[model samples]
Target chain A: MTTYFNEMYDSGKVRPPYARLEDWTRSMPAELREMKQAEAEALFRRIGITFAVYGEGGDPDRLIPFDMFPRVFTSGEWARLERGIKQRARALNAFLVDVYGRGEIVRAGRIPGRLVYRNAAYEKAVVGFVPSKGVYSHVVGIDLVRTGADEFFVLEDNCRTPSGVSYMLENREIMMRMFPDLFRGNRIEPVDSYPEKLRRTLASVAPTKCERDPTIVILTPGHFNSAYYEHSFLADLMGVELVEGADLFVEGEYVFMRTTEGPKRVDVIYRRVDDDYIDPLCFRPDSMLGIPGLMDVYRSGGVSICSAPGAGVADDKAVYTYVPEMIRFYLGEEPLLKNVPTWQCSKTDDCKYVLENLHELVVKEVHGSGGYGMLVGPKSTKAEIEAYRARVEADPGNYIAQPTLALSTTPTFVDEGIAPRHVDLRPYCLVGERVELVPGGLTRVALTEGSLVVNSSQGGGVKDTWVLAE
Target chain B: MILTVDHVTLYRYDRPVRGLVQSHRLMPSTCTGQRVLNWAVTVTDGLAGGAFRDGAGDWIQGWSVPGPVSEVAVTVRGTVETTDQAGVLRGHRELTPPDCYLQSTPSTRSDLALAELAATVAGHDDVLDAAHRLSGLVSEAIVYTPGATAATTTASEALALGKGVCQDHSHALLAVARQAGLPARYVSGYLLVEGDGAAEGQEAAHAWAEIWVRGLGWVGFDPANRCCPDDRYIRLGSGLDAQDAAPIRGTARGTGFEKLDVTVAVQAVQQ
Candidate 1:
């Protein structure tokens, strides 16, 4: 395996734009290093950075592991990535609109309705409601991995409350102090404007009847959610209240949030809760994280929710295969970014091919994320592969197979020294009246050796993403 | 033909709780073709809560907890409905239709408009076609942004902003259907899917809508997916909109936030 640092720096493929990186590394005293590490841990705890482990008993709070080194991207590289993400989000949104609004694609036989309907994320509740700007996925996080210089592949799509943007901001703050000289020497673009951009995007969705300054709030599932810290952090940075389900109510054709002064009219809500749990009356009747009758208010145009519910139908892994076609069909533009090679199990030919190549392909459950329900063919035992094969045979419609490519690696801090770790980047895009891409993104690293899972739910860690100025 | 429905749910918490209590009342009905087969109630107060049902026939399930009780008690009631067609079952409630009152109001809520829309679309070829058109339009129109709107979102508001949750979708369709003079109602049900194992945060209780047609009487339509209800759908209850047949409805004591997770599964049994 190639050593990421050696290949990037010593081999001259890429260099740390920070001129003082070497100097800072040499000058770092043992005591200072220890203090910095201690400080990093403290910052995470102070910020309450955490991710929920599904079955892990007791406290669901697990600090998101952070690395001191921030990944750097030049202005040119960032520009390409920005355009690519925008184009991808636009296309995906368009695809959702077409799939749910019109059966044109399905009629044209490019995709199948059975596959779309079978997708676990598809909601039958949101049939005819149109959003303010004709945008379904307001906040989109597209995970990308670099295979080589100027070569990146789509890893995954997080259209529903994609998190870790706050971590990107917080990580940068800690890294700046840890490597002040390096940061000062580098031309890293400031990611501090993200909260402002996000606020603007959310504010743009405020109801028309509201005053010039619409009351906006961040609806969270509360402190137990793994991304609770990010939710509170973003709400604080954006100057909005962080509200849980009980904090809001709907009545008299308007959506009101329970505040210190009783029910206050809220014009916009930046919610981090999943669609199913957003409104008890509409999606999940038993969900306590949602406000009853809230959906009625949204449908009445009394308020606007960011990244509207049921948008997941578009981001469904089964529907992901037709994104490029959707972009061309809706926007009349070619996709700026390319999707990873994916095979739909619903298709007879695809299923046959996937079944035949079970031992060589990576199989993923259609509705799964956070690296769950995935089988790494090359790394699996014969028994595991056989079980997966049986599962696929039993329910071919629930799985998708893809060839396992050598995911690109980056230099990650380890006990011995900086070693190569597979990494992926998820940059968030905000779409309200317009699309805004944050300068930096969440850089997830596969901490385990030879492991492709970079989700925090797995044993993955993260680093700050730095988009450098030209 | 006799129709039976069973909804089983299991809820697990991160930590064990001290106490738990749950209660639910069924919708008062006087339909002749429907008969209660078997009713069972169970609650696990410590760490996990589970409820199960076994029997036959078309049934609508509803739950209501009176107060903020922690221990989960789920009541499973089965209703057998006799149908003229073989292997084709139907369940109907002819009380004061909830949508009638909502439609009577000259309000501009999205539910009214959506009901009106559903009614308008119901005149189309089939339930599948109408559902497809409605779902497609809603999906195209509404941007999926969380916290944008809540359950009480009005038809005018959702139509104006074009955003909302399943309640909004159901209400909007109900409004549109009412406007078009169609007897459309809301449905609460469990969608059976693969990947919903015990471990992986793999469970969700789902809601949709249903329209009563001439020949078909009442048929299921999912505007969210733009399709007619099929095998994957497990019907629980139907009402004017989300409020009437809410799966779990009741008041609670705690003032702060209350977290809830519901997992439902319906498996086809071999005779």
Candidate 2:
């Protein structure tokens, strides 16, 4: 039996960051806590922010359960995480610019050439084209998990348009609305300025062709998409027009959005659409969701795309193993955050070890996400382990295994009472002309007892994360 | 050798579209093999958009035509001086690494037969010799027969049928070369065959395969003609396959049935 770290208490003593929350929970009666949970759900439904993060493909209208217990981190702790995340964002952008340019890292033999060039995510269309401000992933979402108070590891990176930021903003709003007195007592960092900061970050990377104030728009796949609510929500908050593929057209040297008055030139597009569906003439010929000839305009520096096309190459799971090496090669600095020790089944030695220890390791597909296509060693039955073993044996390169991490737990509101459940944090780090990160992030709690998967698609709930001021 | 090229493509839509956009790689390549004296590309009643050289050293241009029109004609006329360096592509400025070409597309993916053919080069110690053997094997595997295969035919299909055009030959060569662990790409260009009926009819829009040799960079091999790209071959651009290296890629808005007619003429110009 593994002993998970309890973030709220160490040796039965309340931690410093969670000290204030101890009395707040103790003073609240059971009925009052239930009512507040109901109230938080009502507020979320009213605001129409109920949608699954990361397009998990479950009920789009289903409201992810909201826990009233707020996860707290001290100013001192948050300061370190901020530095690490921002440093990671900078290094990621630097790697993108380098790979798309001379590929100095590959030339220096730090990373394999086939891993960068032959990877499915490496786009041939955007080979030599560099976006403005040299930023590829405009918004970098780093998913972090903690084992101890000071030991945190990055699970993976969401470089190409990470969703769930709307949840971060809305969770804080609800926490403030329900507990006004808590705000008066504690000095928590405000996350209301995220929209404004995101707007500034987008506008800062506008193409040089824009002679005046750049017109920005959010390009969404459509209302039927799983994250359509967040797309329109972010557009409304950022005060930018939300448009689809049909609402945009390509003219001479630029992309233009159709308006009521006339066709307006769009300088920057925060596209929620995937790269394969963003240009018909360049990528898939059957893609009706993409503007024709958009790649030509992008390559010629006529417009800018947030999270520029081909940015997915850096976040690929096989490529994810080298991000720390990228930090060393590009930034000349040691990585602030540690990567989960991974064994790529592609290697003969690693595959041999993983095959024998199928009952003790967590195996995941190289390209799968949202807690899908994974086999949890301890939780899975013998039949499940055997089935996954066959899959791993069939294609060793498609799977990677990592030791089951002892994920930390936070005090979560349960049906019986407050109990400790495993949790994870995902902070949105904005990288444009400057690197910026809001103090707070979205905290996901696995509602099931002893469950370590914190994905919303896997019965996980969310909590309002708090970064208290010093 | 000086060569002149005149190519015309006519697109007739049954119903007039709202508009049409096209990305073109029609301009001749810039390398030691070819030098363009003058070149012009005109799309009927179209506005020229952005123009830039791609990482593959191809000059790409964009054009858009606002429609309510029935027919659009794209005309290309250029004069290029060519020299043969024994099929070696030298002095070509390209940013994409040679290994990137090893990636396979649907048209260039290998099948069992292709893999078997790729194994024939096992005894050759020299990569150049091995590449030449692969080209010779592909030329023998698929005989040059026009109209036997369509534009969408894959290398596997062409190898099985044993009859195809230059596109199929090039795709087949790309498949076998890549399967043999050699980086290869499809090269599209014009072949001036003097008075040959095949060159004037079906082979004018010629395509070949270029294999990456470690010391020699890229070396051209024309399996259809059973020779290397010489002074008679005017190289335009290259890609993973024929569709990727196509001179014109276009999309027209509004529901309309489109009909295409293309005619190309390549003539040797006396200096």
Expressed as tens digits, the lDDT of each residue in B25-86 for candidate 2 is 99888889788998999999999999999989999999999878789999999899899889
What does the lDDT read for residue A142 in candidate 1? 90
Which tens-of-lDDT digit does each residue in B1-271 have in candidate 1?
2333454434333444322222122321223333435445443332211111101111322222222344454534343433222112254433222223233222223454455555556557665456446656665555544467766666567666877655556666666655555556676764443452323332235566666555655555665444565544545555555665565543333443445654344443343
Over 4 Å off in model 2, which ranges?
Answer: A52-58, B195-201
- Worst ten in a row by lDDT for model 1 chain A: A1-10
TM-score of chain B of each: 0.56, 0.97
Model 1 regions more than 4 Å off? A1-7, A10-23, A26-32, B1-271
Among incorrect, acceptable, medium and high, the docking class of model 2 is: high
> What proportion of the true contacts does each candidate reproduce?
0.00, 0.75
Task: Report the number of the highest-TM-score candidate.
Answer: 2
Model 2: per-residue Cα lDDT over A289-402, one tens digit each:
889998899999889998899999899888889999998998899999999999999999999999999888989999888889898898889999999999999999999998
lDDT of each: 0.65, 0.91
lDDT of 1 by residue, A1-470 (tens): 43333213546544655344546655766567667778899978876777777765656776778877566677888899899899888877776666555547766777766556445565544444566667778889898877666778786787788888887888888887667777677778888898999888888878655667888899998887777878888989999999998787654456677777776888888889888888765556578898765665565466788877768877778777777777787778888887889998878999999988887898999888888888889889999999999999999988998888667676666765566778889899888889888788899988888787788888899988888788
Best by lDDT: 2
